[model samples]
Target chain A: MNPGELVPAMSGRAWRVPPRSLVEVIDVEGSQTGDVFAVPTDDLEDGLSNGRTFDYGESIRLTTGSVLYSRRSRPLLTIVEDEVGTHDFLWAPCSQEMYEIGYGVTEPHPNCLDNLTASLGGFGVPAATVTIAFNVFMNVAVGQDGGLAILPPATAAGQSVTFRTERELLVAVTACAATTANGGAAKPLRVRITEGAGSPTQGRA
Target chain B: MNPGELVPAMSGRAWRVPPRSLVEVIDVEGSQTGDVFAVPTDDLEDGLSNGRTFDYGESIRLTTGSVLYSRRSRPLLTIVEDEVGTHDFLWAPCSQEMYEIGYGVTEPHPNCLDNLTASLGGFGVPAATVTIAFNVFMNVAVGQDGGLAILPPATAAGQSVTFRTERELLVAVTACAATTANGGAAKPLRVRITEGAGSPTQGRA
Candidate 1:
């Protein structure tokens, strides 16, 4: 990596590490978005520090105005608005390398990395600033057996999520690990974005 | 948008497109990743003249040997392996202005388009070859009153989708959208990418 270059922000609530100035993700066709996802820009490590445990409510049990706390015992993000039904908190990001290795070098369609860079450049954010992101649409769960399982049926379609800004930050969002394993390989989804109306929604934006 | 540059093959199934191409995008987590997805190569388009839909059993969908028919009704690509649950027929690509305007610049984060350019350059893909895309993960269902309504329960986590290449191609992926409306604004998720086995789990790879 270059000295001036930065990795992209994580996809889920971890994005709160350096939370975007404003954030929004839409759920086209009966998919649910996250209710409370947040991070602290001041301490990205705190967002996803090793051995940290943040109590997450069941994706199916989430309600409006859900407050999400970080493992660091701080306010992360919140869920101010939700349409559709609920959002998933377990999906992963998509990437080109993964696509190539997972599928083959010849696999055609673009992956998440391709899309995020373009958006970053368009916003005048230097490509060098790209960092790992925190995705809000995915559903990664910890099973009772200590296994990391991405729970399905976590979200409904037409569900939207809004993240208000606590500060001016560059945020990134991607659809997710829409693979045959995750049950999103059939149809693409629709995501929309809207600004926050003063109050920060789930520490998102 | 320039013609002098060499672009990646664009296809529905992905594998049918040219190899080693590039794609660009703006937003992610905020809106649907498919809201602005694309397929830009001509040769890649010519390959998928026939329609091939991957319909896996209820537990999983997506045919590895089948091909995709792009919006232009052209052959997009082929499925190499689908470790994820399913691939979508309706996702959109990510964008920037969409985020700034739709999500409100107040707390705006990096969209897909921005991410695309950066990723392309990072991967050594010329910027000229990259182009914008249409939505891939989204669907706008028709309502009884002829109005459009968002479908619920769109995607699940741990779903991995992989495409195989019949030709060289470029690709991009983002998880964030700029739209905060519809309740998509909450927290960000985590997106990661890794290489997969060259062999396709379905058969094509």
Candidate 2:
């Protein structure tokens, strides 16, 4: 796949990934977390449910071969390739409130919640219904005492994780705006898409 | 609290808890998990978000003084008394799909998802909008390798966890229907409500 399609810093984009196709999310500038969300093209209510995925998958770590499940207990996507195996499922998309409360930012801030909602808003998924994300290149660790922390991802520049869509999926990916989540800064990413081995490249920030 | 108000096994109930009032969820028959959900009384859109609670609280364990947060980053309830400190926020409410897929049960099984939705259906929150819950008296542990398991609760018969409602809220509790969640048996629960010392006790599974 080419260097992929650019998703600007602190912004998002949505596109349709053909069923049985390969879709890769690339960390163009490393350590920038991407909030990944997918809902079936036809229905937004049945969105990614981390509760179901972890319940069925039996492991919190989603690496290669991990099948992402939906709220209705259906497989939505399969992780076929992973360069950064340590992704995060423990966080909600960052919000303006998070900035104000956690970072003491008084002004309006661009955040993944708004980005994802707006990106999928054109596709009819309302802001309230937006599901919690699967964070690409975001590292999370739970301590022996059950303390959860967001650690900087070990993903390097140009590395990527690819997925196989179980069906035609409306996928949205955002370069997360939370500085605390992405080491100490936010950067861009890319997305590459192809139908099969011989298919032309169709696909980030 | 007079043994609380009964919530039958494999079912649920919903009621308005006055702001600042003390409400207790009693695992009447012991080892029963009550899937707890709360939404602002006037707004169904802002519901329980375990992710937010854990994100801000920094721990998976909920006990006395733990405040339950809403999806919008608002505090909805506060745990004032917890006899069983190991409540769970990890698992989604059990469903028929779990019965069929995990246990090979073919019949339409009574589950906490349906029970919660049905109990709160009268309040106008559509089944599709019901959020993942905070499980009362449920024990869940994560292993060193990030393996998640549902273990039997340590709450004995008649033990209860009390909460202080931060606002007028529509609180729902269901006796979890999954046998795996409740030490291999589905059992009833109760709710006890009290305004203050010397006040009338009002409270279930």
Candidate 3:
């Protein structure tokens, strides 16, 4: 991989991240939510499981130095550095059903699941591989009564979170399409996959 | 710390875990929730923060290999091994207000915050340091509509999760008192603080 290759993750589009690289998801404009999902190159059933990650780490909110694990309790990636400290781990990637059920949108809509599925199609990977995602810069707060409030991104422009892949895997990055829930019209996102100089397991920043 | 000292975490009781130790929370019986919280020995404001951990990890659900980071993004502990993989990081520690509001219990009830506060009182730590906790064996699910459901525990008897401390800190463990929410009467728990033979930073299973 190149040392500093930049990839444009347009609104409602997904990109496949190469392994052994640092994937940086940058919020080009404030209040844009980036949805990210991953699956091992060899198997789809062993994809990332948010439930398992929450159980093992014993937390719902994440920050730097945390490892994103697969369903089988294996390290898939590690968060080496982060500038936006708030993100959502509770909500699923938006789907057509979600738009219709939650927002009464009957027409076809661009969603994260579709973007990810199409992006992985080139690799001959099935859509089933698209499981739970790490909602970068998406703020979802849990109330005192255990209620969840999905709020817009509080991250400033140019803020980002970087992840180092721990194994050979296929990652999908999506700029979400929800306009109202995400605060405004979805904006373009910048994703950069760079080859770091040190060990991938080393925590940075 | 001894090699294998068994500390009884009696129902509704709390214990302060020592630093440089492996803290194990054991569900002596099935269907029990153990509330666990921690704070730095030198600073109360630098206590464990679930929001920060979630943001750093980039996932809400955790598993082994996940580092629980403090408010300042410093790692406080790491999940070395886990027998019961279902835990909760979304809900706050049960308090008197929660008991009154959720269950309509007006009288004083055995709560996690009170237990943790009293446990740290002898060390001159105030009750304000008691923050959110890792609810071991507690299962809370997030719905597609961004709603949270606090479910009954799915952990079986003797299932446990062990943590390796990364810094000198004080930890509090409480066997929950909500019999209904726990699926049955809350049972006693076992907490063992063992001195490891290797470096504290080593991740083990």
TM-score of chain A of each: 0.54, 0.92, 0.89
Question: After superposition, which runs of candidate 2 have C-alpha atoms over 4 Å from their true positions?
Answer: A1-3, A196-205, B1-3, B195-205
Report the C-alpha lDDT of model 1 over A28-95, residue by residue, as the tens digit: 54332222223345533233210011122212223345444332334444555655333432222345
| Residue B36 accuracy (lDDT) in model 2 | 90
* TM-score-best of 1 and 2: 2
The residue-by-residue lDDT of candidate 3 on A95-151, one tens digit each, is 665567567898998887677778766666665445457888988876543445678
Q: Which of the CAPRI classes, incorrect, acceptable, medium or high, describes model 3? A: incorrect
After superposition, candidate 3 runs with Cα above 4 Å error: A1-19, A196-198, B1-205
TM-score for chain B of all predictions:
0.46, 0.91, 0.89
* TM-score of candidate 2 relative to the true fold: 0.93
Models, CA RMSD each: 19.5, 4.2, 18.9
lDDT at residue A76 of model 2 (Cα atoms): 81
What is each candidate's DockQ, to 2 decimals? 0.02, 0.59, 0.02
Instruction: Say which candidate scores most in lDDT.
Output: 2
The runs of at least 3 residues in candidate 1 whose Cα sits more than 4 Å from the true structure, single-residue gaps closed, are A1-24, A32-77, A82-92, A103-109, A124-131, A181-196, A200-205, B1-205
By lDDT rank, best first, the candidates go: 2, 3, 1
lDDT of 3 by residue, B1-205 (tens): 4333333433344345556678887877778887777777777546666655664554567667777766445678888888877787756677675567567898998877677777766566655445467788887776543445667888888788988887777877888877755876767777877755325555642
Question: For candidate 1, lDDT tens digit of each residue in B1-205?
Answer: 2222111111111111244222222122322333222244443222111111211111112344544433233334455544332233312223444344334465546555555545544545443222223233333342222123344323343333444432344444444443331135422222222223233333442
